[model samples]
Target: MSKKVLVTGADGFIGSHLVEELILQGYDVKAFCYYNSFNSWGWLDSFPKSLLDKIEIFTGDVRDPNGVRTAMKGCDMVFHLAALIAIPYSYHSPDSYVDTNIKGTLNIIQAAKDLEIERVLVTSTSEIYGTAQYVPIDEKHPKQPQSPYSASKIGADCMADSFYRSFDMPITIVRPFNTYGPRQSARAIIPTIISQLLNGYEEIKLGDLTPTRDLLFVKDTVKGFIEISKSNFLIGHECNIATNSEISMQKMADTLIHLINPSAKIIQDTDRLRPEKSEVFRLFGDNKKIIEHTNWKVEHTLEQGLQATIDWFSEAENLKQYKAGIYNV
Candidate 1:
């Protein structure tokens, strides 16, 4: 029998990809998709039938402790990837972020502790290291919570660390910086650019083009998770799955435009702009820790990843799901 693995948030962008990869690798995959009235599995619905048939999906909310505990039973490893991730959405309803990101994570950690799960990978973000006070941000860099989303993740990371120190629970904090690819929600920069360009928009509306970020392709990020899970060196460690590279939003948008539709021009949209002080000005990660610890390497350059994402969105079936004109918070 394959090692049983439970992946929470398997209905979202990265989570769905991770599930497919896990199934391909022969893990007995159990996907925890959020329960919804429409019975929608979100992006999980897009998986090929061959891969889908191999997965055992359980519908539940990570916010519900009883539900989480029930799903965690009999699983050898847990990948906690469920959370309210959109920064703009967090601005309007921070309480939900607290409930889902903080309390929701708390429930997972507690369940892992109770069940003595061998490995628990709690997902984190570069947003925790807000506005990059210094270049090449590392694991030791000071954390500044600029948004409610970031604040909640910081709190969650702290809680995960405490579990390791206090209870000797095996946990790893997997931080990925600005992950983007196919199936990504319109709230992300890459999808926003692609959607607008695909919709035949001449002028793309955007915000804060000056800010720099270390972009990690979704496949690379998912591979990083698998590597960390396999590595003995990563136990109880906070590892970043990132390219030690950076790109400004303007340059990134320009590259996307040139690749997809050269006629498109960028227009600043005030509504999409993050608060001045809260904006993560620069984020170039130092990926030496994960690199030295495991054989994982970043396979896709931003250009390659962007092209693949654009190709996916170019499809009428895929493009129909997104609203390109509206600014997604």
Candidate 2:
């Protein structure tokens, strides 16, 4: 029998892609999506009916400890991806971030320890590093929580670490740099730019153009998770999935503008600007650890990934889902 695995937050962007990839790799997948009255599973709802048939759907809130434990009962391993991730929204609703990111992660790790799960991969983000004090940041780089969202993720990462050291539970902190692709929310720069331009906006509204990011395609990010899960060397360690390259917001926007509509221009929207202290000015991650430990390599270049994203968004059915006119917080 194939190893049965549970993936929480399988309804979200990266989570949904991970689920699809795991299924393709022949794992018996259980998707724990956030419960809702509308019977919606976020992006999972968009998957072809044939693909959805292979998945076991369990709808529940991650913050509920009992629900998380129940979801893990039969699975050999679990991928914990459920959390509040929007930086600006976290500033306005910090308490929710504490409850969902920290407490929700606590629920997953605590349950994994109790159930003696074979493996547990807790998702981390590059945002925790804040502004890179140095280039090509490795696992040993100092963590700086520049925003409330990053702070909660830091707290969650520490909690996962404690579980490994204190209880010897099998766990790995999997961090991915800025991931962009189809189905990404407008809160992110790539999707924000794509949706606005596709809608024929007069000016591409963006925030501070000075910050730089190490962008990773979503497919590559999902593959990194699968590779990490297969490696015992990654247990009790934090690994990054990145391209080991950087691009400033201005340059990225200019490139996207050139690709989509050459006549379009960019205009800074004050509402979109992150607070100076909270802003992460640079994030260029070192992929050496993941490369050394696993059989993963970035297969898509910046142009290739951007083209794939634009192709997906160009679909009329897909583009209609986003409200390009309103600025999403």
Candidate 3:
């Protein structure tokens, strides 16, 4: 029998892709989506019927230990991806971040220890490193929490590490930098740019364009998760799935403009900017650990990824979901 896997936050961006990939690879998947009054499963609604039919969905909040325990029952492996990820939103309501990111992760870790799940891959972000103190930031880079979102993640990562050391829980933290592709909300730069351009905005509104980031395609990020899960060598270690490259916001905008419409002009929007000191000036991750451990490789180039995202947003059905006029937090 194939391994039974439970994917928390399976309704969201990368989670949805991970679910699809796992199903393709012949895993018996249980999708743990956040429960809602409407019983909606966010992006999972967009998945094909055949694929969706194969998944067993458990709807519940990660903050509730009982709910997490129930969802994780009988699953051999768990991929915990649920969290409040928006940096801007984190500033406004940091308590939610702590409860959901840190506490939620703790619940998962504790449950995993009790259940003796074969493997657990907790999703982490490149934001935890804050502004890169060193070029090509590795797993060893000192963490500087520039935002409450990153801070909450750092705490959760520590909690996972402690679980590994103290209880011998099998866990791996997979951190991906600036993932962008289909189903990505407008809160991220690439989707923000594409949504505005597709909507025929004459002057694109943006925040500080000087900061640099290492962008990974959503598919590449999903591949990293799968590769790490299969590799027994990565247990109890933190690894980054990145392109080991950098791109400025201004250049990113230019690249988007070149793809969609060249006439779009970029304009600064103060509301979109993060607090001066809190903003991460740069993030270029080192992928050496993940590459050395498994056969994971960068499958999508920046141009290829951007074009794929552009094509997805270009569809009228997909474009309608986004409010292109407003800046997403």
Candidate 4:
């Protein structure tokens, strides 16, 4: 029999992709999606009928311990990907970030400990490192939470570490740098650019184009997660899945513009700009640890990945879902 796995936040972009990948890898998957009155499963609902039928969907709030515990039952491993991730939204609602990211992570760890789940993977973000103090940041780099979103993730990481040290619970922190591809929310830069250009917009509204990111494709990230879960050496450790390369927002936008609409221009929209202190200036991650520990490698080049993303967003049905004219966050 295959190992049963539970993936939290399976309704969102990366989470949905992970679920599909896990299913393809022959794991019996249970998806924990945020409960809503609309009865929507977010991106998970976009899956094909065949794929959707294989998943066991649990709808509940991650912040609720009871819900988390209930969803974790009968699963051999847990991938905790649920969190409040939008930095701009976090600035306006730091309290919700605390409740969801920190407390919700606490709920997962506590429940995992109690249940003695074989392995638990907590998702971390590149934003936790803030502007890189040094190039190609290793796992040992100092964490500077420049924004509330990063602050909550930092708290969550500490909690995961505490569980391992204090209770000897098995946990791994999987830190992914700037993962992008199909199904990404318009709030993200890549999708923001793609949707606008595909929507026939002449000007792309953006902010702070100088900040750099170490981009990773979603497929590679999901593969890294699966590989990490299969290895016993990564327990109680943090690892990053990155391309070991960086791209500035301005440069990335220009590349997309060149492909989609060469005539389109990037416009600095004041509303889209982040507060001076909250912006993450640069993120170039070192993937050496994960590469050494797991059977993972960069599969897609930036050009290839961006092309795939553009193709997905170019679909009339998909492009219609995003409001290219307005700032998403």
Highest lDDT scorer: 2
| Stretches of model 4 off by over 4 angstroms after superposition | none
Per-model CA lDDT versus the true structure: 0.92, 0.95, 0.94, 0.93
Cα lDDT tens digits for candidate 3, 1-329: 99999999999999999999999999999999999999999999988898889999999999999999999989999999999999999999999999999999999999998999999999999999989989899999999999999999999999999999999889999999889999997799888999999999989999999999999999999999999988888998999999999999899999999888899899999999999989999999999999999999999999999989989998999999999998889
Model 4, residue 237: distance off in Å is 0.6
Once fitted onto the true fold, the runs of candidate 2 whose alpha carbons sit more than 4 angstroms away are none
Models ranked on lDDT:
2, 3, 4, 1
Query: Each prediction's TM-score against the native?
Result: 0.99, 0.99, 0.99, 0.99
- Steric clash count of candidate 1: 0
Which of 1 and 2 is the better model by TM-score? 2
List the candidate 1 regions with Cα displacement exceeding 4 Å.
none
lDDT of 1 at 214: 96
Better model by lDDT, 2 or 4?
Answer: 2
Per-candidate alpha-carbon RMSD to the true structure: 0.8, 0.6, 0.7, 0.7
- Better-scoring candidate (lDDT), 1 or 3: 3
